[model samples]
Structures are given as structure tokens and as C-alpha cells.
Target: MIFLKLFRESFLFAYDALRQNKLRTFLSLVGVTIGIFLIIFVFSAVDTLKNNLQKSVNKLGSNSIYIQKWPWVNNEDSPWWKYLQRPTPKLREFDELQKRSQTALAVSYEISIDNRIVKYQSHTVEGAQIDATSHDHDKTWNFDFEDGRYFTEMESRSGSPVTVIGHDIAADLFPDGGAVGKALKIMGRNVTVIGVFKKEGSDILGISDDKEILLSLNFAKNVIDVQNASYNPQIVVRGKNGLSDLEVESEVRGLMRSIRRLGPNNEDNFALNKTTILSNQLDIVFNVLTKVGGFIGLFSILVGGFGIANIMFVSVKERTNIIGIQKSLGSKNYFILLQFLIESIVLCVMGGLFGLGMVLAVAALVKAGTDVQIVLDIKNIIRGISYSIIIGMLSGIIPAYFAAKLDPVEAIRSN
Candidate 1:
């Protein structure tokens, strides 16, 4: 009951102080408001960027691993010349990997050959990225359909003239007519469109969006030789949910060695790359950005904390006579301290809330104006409010203590 009474009295006193000197209160809180806004904005932006990057990387496949001639990141001990001289992984090696690997759930071969104009009667889509893959490609690439179904295993193996077009290609080549069940000319060979891929939003890395054309592996091989180093394909291997990536990688590594007839002493010529590596790189980048942002924000908050303390000191000085009268009326020292402390906390929290509102408004504005989706989640909101209350307590303690210690006679005599 005492705590509730003290709280009500303190809040009323704080409200009255604000009404008496509105400009002074506003000026004191300006620093805190700006400081919170900066810190929250920076963190919010970085998190949004990280989410975008992860989504982009995930489109490729999180559980998939790639076997390629060139390494994604080169080791200091390994010579670049040796990796260059290594033979490109071919259909024969893929066959060997498929037969030998036990942990692999799905295996696929894909190659991006060349860009070409896709023609359907009078419609032509220029500069569409032409891709060729085997039947299991869908498991690794994760295609969502807009029109029809993916090509079957038999069609891919028998060199069927079937294709699946992307959103942009379908719109361009078959604007008037339907894309599925229609014929289009790719690389001068007539191919039937079996499916149209759904529209996927733009990505940060600018890869795997919506401007691609997928065809059968055998058909692509007939057009361009797999022996050519320039047109080398990537072999993707995926493990089931229960399987560890390291186990899958180990199996693939051992199989590749057997296929290439590598001696025990020879270094690994082929590289096994995981999709998570891309996400890992992005995580490192965003972590550094968050730290830098936090460091810059801390300096501003220090200045704001001092500003709030000054405000509390001024409020205490203005109410010294009130403190003297209350003491003479038998008010306890702790009551005076609690009142000033609550008032300071209220002032700081109001400032913090204003800053949070500004941040939210800015994020909404950016999202509305741009293609980017800016977000400020609930966790960050809670963090901002907590910081505000803590800063308030730190700033108010000393002034509240001084108010509590003031001699009743001296405070009443103050001019």
C-alpha cells in the first residue's frame, strides 16, 4: 500500500513538473531519443540484410553439396595450377559417385551452357540463361511450379526435347498463348515447354531469380560437348534430414578418389562445396556490422545519460521547499528518494518510446518506397525499452539520494 501511494504521488509530481517547464523537459530528452533511434535503426537494418542474404542462399539448397573442378575458397598449401590442371567432373564420374555413395539421398548434374533467344512462333525472349540438368535436379534446385509438372526420369535419360521456362521467359515468349504444352526453339533445336516456374522474388546475390530455362541433360550434351572445360558441369549431392553433411562429404570424397585413381599421397584435386558456406560468409559480415553499429551507438547514449541526470538535478533543486515541507509533515526520507527516482524513470521512458516510434515510422517508409522489406521485430522493441529504463535508474540515483538527504530547515530556507 505504501509503495502504491508513493508511486501515485511521484507520477503526479512528475506530470506537474512537465506541465510547468515543457521546453526544458523536451530539450533534456532530445539526446536520449536520437541515441535510441540510431542504435535501433542500425541493428534493424543489419538483421533485415542478413535475412535477405540467407533467403537468397537457401534457394540453392541448404542440404546440398557441390562437386566442382574449382574450389570456392582456395587453401594456402594447395597450388592453383594443380586445381586448374585437374580433369573436369564428367558423366562417368557422376555415375561412379551415384553407385558408390550410401549417405546421398539425391544426386544431380547441372551445367549453365550459354544465353540464347527462346522463340515460340512470333514471340522471342532474348538473353535467357539456358540451363541443363538430370532428373534429380528438382531435389537440389527446389523449383515451384506456376503451370505444369517437371520432366520425368525417362524423358531426361532418353534426350527428350522438353523444357521448363522461368517466369520472365514464359511472359515474354508466350504472352498471348500458353507456355505449357507449347513448342519453343532453343539453340536452333525445337523443344516442348512442359512447365513454367513460379516467380521468385529478387535476391541479394543476383542469382537463381526468374530468368532461366531448364532442359534435359542429354539434349544439352548433344548441342555442346561435356569434354570442353569451358562448359564443365556441377555435380550436386544431397543427404536426408537425419544424415550429417560431413558423412555425405566423406563418402563423396572417397568415391571421387577411387574414380580418378588418385594415390594415397596425392592431394585432393576436386572440391566438395556446401551451400551453407555462403550463409556462413554472410553471418560473419553481418556480425561485424552489428558490433560497429553498437560501438557508435554507445557514445551517443553516454551523452544522453548525462543529459537525463542534469534534468533530475534541476528538478530536485526546483522542489527543495516542497521536500522541506513534506519532511516537516513527517514524510520519510525514502519516500522523497522514491518519488524523484520514479519521475526520472518516467521522463526517460517517454523519450525512449518516442525514439522507437520514429524508428518504426522510418522502417515502414523505406519498405513502402523500395523493393526491400524492412523489419523491426518484437525482440528489438523489448531490448530498446529495457535499455531506456536502465539508463533512467542510473541517471536518477544520485539526484534522488541528494533530495532524500537534504536537511528540512536548510531546504525550507532556500531562495
Candidate 2:
């Protein structure tokens, strides 16, 4: 009961200090406010980047492997001519691998052609992305259909003139919602639209399916040379549910080597790419970025701490006569210390809250201006508040101690 009464009285004293010197209190809080804003804003930006990156990486399946001529990771030691000379993965190799591999659940041969045009009647979507894949592509890659279905085995093998369009294409060409069974002209050949991909907005990696059209590999041969190295033909392999990507990659590497007749001393020509490679590289980059941001924020916070300490010391001096009067009237040393400490804390907390509000405003503005999302999560809020409390304690301790130790007679005589 006594402690509660003491707390109530101390809180009132802190409030009174703020009300009596509003301008001085506001100026004293500026440093802490800017410091909190800098740190929280940096943290929020880094977290937003990480989230977008993870979403992009997920689009390329985490457990899938890509067999291609060029490696995803850059190697300064290796000559570029080596990769340029490597042969593009062939359909024959893909067929052989499917027959031999035990760990792979699904294997697909895929090639892409860009800047193509698709037309329905007078409506046209130019510069469209087109992907040609074997029938097993559905099993290797994850996707959902907004309408119709993927190619059947017979249709894929027989080079049937069937196609799947992305949401953007469907919306552009057939805004009324019934896109399936419509015939669209591509490469001067009319093909039946068998499916429409679900809507996926633009992402940082430009891998969204919103602007792509999918067709069978056999059918794509009539439009472009499927075996052309310029088309970037690659094989995608998805591991079984229980198997790890490493296990799948190992089996794929051995099989490719055997198929190419490469001896033990000869290096394999093909590259086995996995999402983990990109994810690990992203981790390194983000870690460095986060550290750099934290370092900059800490400097700002240090300046704020100094400003808060200065204000606290001056506050103690200004209240010296009041402290002496209370002490003469039988107030305890601990009460004086607690009162000053609480006042300093209240000031810092107010500054922190203002900083948080600034961050929220910036986040809202950025979200409105761009597709990117900047979330100020609860974890960061807690962290900001914790920093405020710690700064308040460290800054006010010495001043509170000085006020507590003052001799009533000497303090009463001070101007």
C-alpha cells in the first residue's frame, strides 16, 4: 500500500515537471526520438527485404534441382569458355535419367522463349513469356489452375496444339471470365487454350506466372528449335518426399556423368543448381546489411543517450531546493531517488512512443506508394520500448544518486 502511494506521488511529480517546462522537455526528447526512429526503420526495411526474397526463392521449389550448362554460382577461377562450350541438356538425356533415377520423383525438360505475341481475334498481348515443358512439368513445378487442365500424356507426346495462359493474358484477351476452349494464335499457329494460371502479382525476381504462357515441348518445336542452346533448355528434377535435395543432387550428378561417359579424372560438364545455393548467398548478403544498419542505428542511439543524460543532470540541479525541503520534512533518500528516476523514464518513454509513431507513418506512406510491404511488428515495438527503459535508467542513475545524497542544510542554501 505504501509503495503504491509512493508510485502515484512520483508519477504526479514527473507529470508536473513535463507540464512546467514543456519546451525544454520536447527538445531533450528529440535525440532519443530520432535514435529510435532510425533503428526501428532500418530493422523494418531489412525484414521486408528478407520476406520478399524468401517468397521469390519459394517460387523456385526448395527441393528441386536444375540441370543446366551454366552454374548459378559465379566461379572466378573457372574460364567462361568452359561453360560456353558445355552442351545444353538434351531430351534424350532427360528420358534416360527418368528411367535410371530412383531418388527423383519427377523430371521435366523445359525451354523458354521470350518476346512472343499471342492473339485472340483483334486482342493481342505482345512481349509475352512462353514456356515449353514436357508432360511431367506439372509434377516438377508447383502451380494452380484458374480454368481447364494441363496436357494429357498423349497430347504432350503427339504435339497437340493446346496451351495454358496466365491470368494477365486471360484478363486482357477474355475479360468476361470464360477463357477455356478459346483458340489463340501463337507463332502464326492457332492452339486451343486448355488452362489459365491463377493470378500471381509481380515479384522482385520477375518469376511471376501472371505474364507467362505454357505449352508442350513437342508443340513448341514448330515455333522454335527446342534443341537450340540460345533458348536455354534445362531439365528440372524434383526429389521424392522423404529424400533431401542433396541426396537427389548426388544421384543426378552420378547419372549425368555416366550418361556423358566422363571418366573419374574428367570434370562433369553440367551444373546441378538448387534453391539452397541462392538462399545461402542471400543469407550472407542480408546478414551484412543487417549489421551495417544496426551499427548506424547504434551511433544515433548513443547521441540520444548523451542528450538524455544531460537533461537529467540539469533536472536534478533545478529540483535541488525541492529535494532539500522534502528531506527536511522527513522524506527518505530512496523516495527522492525513485521520484527522479521515474521522471527521467517517463520522458524517455514519451520520446520512444513518438519515434514509433513516426516509423508507422513512414511505413504507411511506403506501402501506399509501392507494392512492397513494411510491417512494424510487435517484436520491434517491444524492442524499442526496452531500449527506452534501459536508456532512462543509465542516463538518470548518476543524477538521481546525487540528488539522494545531498545534505538538506547545504541543498537549502543553494540558489
> What's the lDDT for all of these models?
0.83, 0.85
- The sequence of per-residue lDDT tens digits that candidate 1 reaches over residues 35-120 is 77777888898888877777765776666789999877655886888888987878898888778778888888888866678888
Native-referenced Cα lDDT, model 2: 0.85
For model 1, the superposed segments whose C-alpha errors exceed 4 Å read 1-24, 53-57, 74-79, 121-123, 175-177
- How large an RMSD does model 1 have? 2.7
TM-score of 2: 0.93
